[model samples]
Target: MNFNEFELHEDVLNAVDSMNYQAATPIQEQAIPIILKGGDLLACAQTGTGKTAAYLIPILDKVAHEPHQHTAALILVPTRELAVQIDQQIQGLGYFVGATSIAVYGGNKGPEWDQQKKALSQGADIIIATPGRLIAHLQLGYVKFDQIKHLVLDEADRMLDMGFLGDIMKIMSFLPSPKQTLMFSATMPHKIGDLAKRILNDPQEVRLAVSRPAERIDQQFYMAGDNQKLPLLSHLLTQVSDTSMVLFTSRKNTVEPIVRALRKLGLKANGISSDSDQGEREQVLRSFKNREFPVLVATDVLSRGIDIDNLSHVVNYDVPRDPEDYVHRIGRTARAASKGTAITFINEADQKYVLKIERLFEKEVEKRTIPEELGLGSSPVFNARRSSGGGGHRDRGPRKGPSAEGQGNAGSKKPFRRKKPRSKSAAKAPSSTPTNSAS
Candidate 1:
């Protein structure tokens, strides 16, 4: 559906046109009319489904048509990255409609706190905030929400995962009752349903299918030992052409070490984690977006809502503990129907996690053999049962080959060959159970 079919305000349509948005995404097509009609909504949409614009455009239209004295909409997100991203989108979509907004997040200096105070005490048309920072401002008793007509909890499952339920409830205490509430979550766990029951008032629900990785994403898995993984990664990177990649590690401490290793290999790379200050994190993200570097080594903090376009590849330096996160990590690539690649490095301990990921995908991801030239050692064969018990099969020992030293330019070597494509019957294995939507 086109944005025009929704009968949005003329100025709002102008802004959408300027952004070059031609048609509404599935979530946007279903959610916009409900939001414009002033009804509460509970939408199940994954990342990259245009859920931000789905909520923002209608809210901007309402703000354009109606007069308000205090802040009008409150969008609570899980991370500072997402808070900033949504605020940026609002600036683009709300431009012609003259909507004012601010992103309220933590980890900044005192000046940021003061600025947030001014916006909250007076009013911005929209306030996008992380729960912790917003709660800090609220505790000072200066923030006001009496006039907030719209309340949206985006990525509700993630916020709950990060243990923000208490803070979210406390934040809700300050808002007026009988307002429109919209909750969008990627997964529908019981806790999400429980929270929705308490907060939402007879909301219309929209559930999209569980989003699989885009067909354009070529998913590949490699079985390697912990010691051999880095050499293997260096080898693989050399095989690809100039590419934009985000390498996700589950641990923050490993981010710098991996970055240093890549840099020593003569690859331009940078690292970011929670330990990095807010300004530095923003700068790193900005530089990566501007193509200042080809690889960004980060923790799962960048996995969820940070939008970097044209990402050619995603490398899972470590498999995520949660199966759903594997989806979000690779979902960064193959965005907007574009082709991309997702590569995962699985050590012995992480083999079981791969099994869970395959269950989620409903098909086995292709596993590749390590290049013989690196010759770090014999790689562990995948055995789900043994790996599930935290044990892996014994290796035969190191194979004879050149050391990782001075082998950084392996791209000039023979290109790595992938396994042949699987048959359609094997790829389309049917599920015995029905898929359930997030409640």
Candidate 2:
């Protein structure tokens, strides 16, 4: 349905029009009404489904109508990039209504901390935060949540996977006894259901397609040996000019080498991983988005939540061990009804991972043989059409069950909360709170 049919506040309608948003996504259409009615909701939606706007539009509409100066709505996200993106969307959608929001996350200097502190104290209408930094502010003691009317856990499944359950529970403890809680997760693993049981009060559910890559993505794989993977990558990019792409490697150490190799071959490339600080990561992403760089080599840290408009392709430089991660990586391309290409490099080392990825999709991914000029023939390791479902050197015994990160008990106990470091050296140094903290 068109957003106009929802008869959202006139101000919101104007902002939507200005933003050129013509229709609500399925998730948005299902979610906005329940949210506007102040009902608790548990929504199962993937990254490309416009989940951000589903929550933001309704919350912004409420904030505009009710006119609260106190932090009216609080949104928790998994990454620094997500917090920034959500805050930016809040601005774009809430523009005509003049709604205000502050993104709260670590990886900032004293000035950012000061600015966040001021907004929290003076009551910004909406606060988008990572779990750790908000806990740090709560420890500082002037922060407010008692008046927060709405609470949203965007990417709730991701937060639990990152081990932020403990932090999320602790944050909830600071909110008033009665408040509206909404959860948006890409998938509902049992732990997510457990989290919903604890935080939501009789919430309605919206479950669309989940844990699958968008159909618009053109999926293909290249069978290459260790010596030929780099050449295959270069061949793929060289075949196209000025393509915006994100290449994912399994380890941070692999990122730089791949980026340098790509640059040596005359592609504009940059790399991002855990080793990069928040500011550097943001700058790299900004440059990648601006087309200042045509290729970005990133680790799984960029797999999930960074929003890049019109991204043309994604390359899995190293196979992801988890099927879910494979979905998330390809998801970076083919977003929001746009078609794009996803390529994977499969060596003998990557065969088992590829099998699992195929199992998740219930079909084999088409495999492209490395050209003779690239120094490899078709992979002899496994037949692409008829994989034993068990290829590679080592036997992958059996899939392990969910780990402690996916356990409900992880949320029951409170973890010790540390105050932000104070000594000058400690304060200035870039540090990380738990990756799951408020993710």
Candidate 3:
């Protein structure tokens, strides 16, 4: 249905018109009214479904009808990128309505925080902040949430995954107990469900676009070993020349190396990770969207919020730790009813993830071989590449020789004996085990 049919305020309708947002996405159509009615909402929506605008539009409308100088609405997000993204959407949809909002997150200059606080005191109606940073502001008596009437947890799954549950509870203690709570997640994990129970009061659940990949996406996989991922990805990008693509890495540390390696191969590629500043991240995204950069490398953090129109392909350079993230990463390409391709790199470590993903999509993703140029054709499968004789990052560098599977060229006659793949339960330690923190 169209935005006009929702009986939004004239200016909101006008803002939608100016933004050229004619039809409401499934999430928007399902969520706008539920939130406008002051009901707590638990929505399951992937990225690229306009989920951000779904709640933002109604929140702005509420603020327009009853303007408040106090922080009337509080939005807690997991990362600064998402905080900025949601704030931007609020501006775009609420521009004509004159709704005032502020984003408070870590990594901002102290002066920026001071200025933002000054604006808050002068009556910023809505506040978006990361959990840790927001808690710090509250502890320092810089934030006034006593007047909060609404609360939102965007990417609830991410928040829980990032170990923000305690911080979330702490923040909730400051809000009015009677306030409306809206929780949005790409997937509803067990923890998310439990958190919703504790926070939301008999919430209305919207399962719009529930756990499904966008229909326009043609999902497939490229089978390779862990070490072969980057080389295959670089080769694939060359094969699909001129297409805008995102390469998804599971770890933040992998982004830069992948970009550097791709560039070494003379490809126009760049990377973005959590460590990247807002300016640099935005530059990479803008360049990719504008076609100045054909390939953009990122982690799961970028998978959900980034929107690039007509992005033709998604390359999963690393298997997502959570299978659900796999769907969101690929969904980036096939948006707005446009067709796109989603190619994932599945190594032995990812075999367990493959089955779960297939079940999620309810279809077997087409498995394809890596390009022969990358040496998947050598005599031995584990054909080790000639190394630079150094360790560390160089040790993990892409291999250079061909595999023995497809060719019998001058290669070692030794058989490639791959160790049996480990079972999922044994592959990873228990969730409570202390793994290194993601940067």
Candidate 4:
């Protein structure tokens, strides 16, 4: 069905037209009407399904009609990235409607928020914030929720995964008891179910489906040795040059090395991990969006709520630990109803996970062997897949990297270096006769 059939407010329709969105996705079509009716909602939709617009459009309608003197709505998201993305969506939908919104999250200084808090105190329409930052504002007496008519919990499963349930409950307590509450997530774990039971009142439950990704994506897999995975990925990047791609690794330590390797190969790549500075992460995201950087390598922390429209490719460099993460990882592409591609690198060690993932989809993933010209040895064991990427971290200063345990000599302590030679002059004469210590 076309968007005109919904008979939404002119403002929302105008926003939709501005975005050139001709039709709504299944989840958006199902949930938007329910949300517009001002009823409590429990929506389960996979990532990249336009879930943000499903709620944002309806909330904007509510805001445009029922003008209030206080904060009218609160959207609590799992991460600062999601919070900012949602805020951007809300603003885009409400741009001509004169609706105002602010994003609140940690890592950003309060100076920028000070002005927003002042405007909000005077009366803000919407607030999209992370739970911790939102509660911090509340504790500082910078926000009041006397007029919160709509409350949204975006990415509820991730919030539970991040152990923010207590903060969510606390924030819920401060809002008016009788309000329209909405919870949206890709998967509804037992904890999310319990939280919904407590928070939602006779909510309309909407589940698009389980284990379904956008049909426009062509999913493929590559079987290679673990040691060859990075080189293979490097090869693929060269083969598919100039496409905006997202590459996912399983661990945080793996990100930097892969990024460095990609850069060394003269490809524009940035790493996103838990330890990355928030400002740098934001810049990486913005650059990726602008096509200034064509590739972003990240962990599952970015699996959901990273809404880059028309993202053409997603690569699974490492199989995700959570089977659900596999769905979200590939979902990054094929967004906003556009066709895309998803490729996964599977080595022998990943064999155990292959079946579990296949069970989730109720079918075997089509496996294709890498070209023999790559020279990865045959019948490789999983341990051969145990490590990938450059092994050492570049220290920023004089401090040594973390030392290995039980490896240091008793008389002399030196961190293990994988490649540097051990000089007999420095080692043999070190303990007994230290002539002079460097000042």
Candidate that would win on lDDT: 1
lDDT of 3 by residue, 171-214 (tens): 98878778889999989878988998999899999886667888
Residues 38-155, model 1: lDDT tens digits: 9999998777878888998898899767878888999999999999888888777776777778889989887787878888888878899999999988989988888899999998
Model 2 over residues 144-178: C-alpha lDDT tens digits?
Answer: 77689999999898899889999999999889867
Q: After superposition, how far is residue 67 of candidate 3 from its true place, in Å?
A: 3.8
Runs in model 4 with CA error above 4 Å?
379-439
Better model by TM-score, 3 or 4?
Answer: 4
Per-candidate TM vs. native?
Answer: 0.88, 0.86, 0.82, 0.83
Off by over 4 Å in 1: 389-439
Model 2: worst 10 consecutive residues (lDDT sum): 430-439
**In candidate 2, which residue ranges exceed 4 Å CA deviation?**
377-380, 383-439
Question: Which has the better TM-score: candidate 2, or candidate 3?
Answer: 2
lDDT of 4 by residue, 47-71 (tens): 8777888888788878877868778
Model 1: how large is the Cα RMSD against the reference?
11.7
Backbone clash numbers for all candidates listed: 1, 3, 7, 1
lDDT of each: 0.79, 0.76, 0.70, 0.71
Better of 1 and 2 by TM-score: 1
Clashing pairs in 2: 77-439, 78-439, 131-438
